[model samples]
Target: MNRDNEKRVTPNLDENELMNLMVDGIRKDGFKNPIETTPAEQPENKKPVIREQNRTERISPTEYEEIFFKEVKSTARHGKSAYIDPVHHKKLTRIVQVIGDDNITIYAYLYNLLEHHFREFEELIKEIYEEKHKPLF
Candidate 1:
């Protein structure tokens, strides 16, 4: 990233355009894990901080839209469930048939439900840990 080419992200940018800019910057500047080879060693002179601040300037909105989504095909992107309750499975199948599999709204609803419960379970686990590991002092 060059200072002459750098542009600040302003509040005036629309949601889609801002997301495109962020995506473009991320896709172009893939992360290099500093932990892979050296955890004990440290870089001198704060090079990582400087590099982080020097983000690539966004391209034009037209070009941003052109590179909107990077086609990342990965086997780990999908998962299969072991089982569903027979009644729920039937209902889900019917819903998919009626609304089509590509519909996002129903899927988002299901995802949100799962996400909310997962967070709840996380907090419960933390509480259990605190109960089991209370400090004496």
Candidate 2:
């Protein structure tokens, strides 16, 4: 390995912009790791915090009309099956068909529904789970 000829390239970006870029990259790529910042390092503007909030919470969709009718692509990941009432299943399928796009999958809509439910009841679910479960230690 030659030690002398390597040229280090550093991007001429503001520290705040660099951090924002990293955060955006992580979000776009669906990386789960949290980016931690001390109070002093935190940006003066609250825009980043608002941007990082859950999409459903930030949008605060008032009705199914806002959330369910949007066009979305199918997820690449495999999903586990949970049986529901046949009526419910048929209703979901009908909703997708009504969208007039055969390419959309029922699972995406179902996933969005579950996401909304979980976000709405997140605190209660956490509290109940903590109360019910005892540590094995």
Reference-based lDDT, each prediction: 0.49, 0.67
Top candidate by TM-score: 2
Model 1: residues with Cα > 4 Å off, grouped in runs: 1-77, 95-102, 105-110, 129-137
lDDT of 2 by residue, 55-98 (tens): 55556434554575555565636667788799998988887787
Error of 1 at 2 (Å): 97
Candidate 1 lDDT, tens digit per residue, 1-137? 67655675545646765676675454434432234434346556433332223323745645532332222233222644446688986776565455443443334434444554577478776887988996879
Among all windows of 10 consecutive residues in model 2, the one with the lowest summed lDDT is: 46-55
Model 1 earns a TM-score of 0.27
Give candidate 2 regions above 4 Å deviation: 1-63, 70-77, 99-103
Native RMSD of candidate 2 (Å): 19.1
Clashes of 2: 0
What are the clash counts of all predictions, listed in order? 0, 0
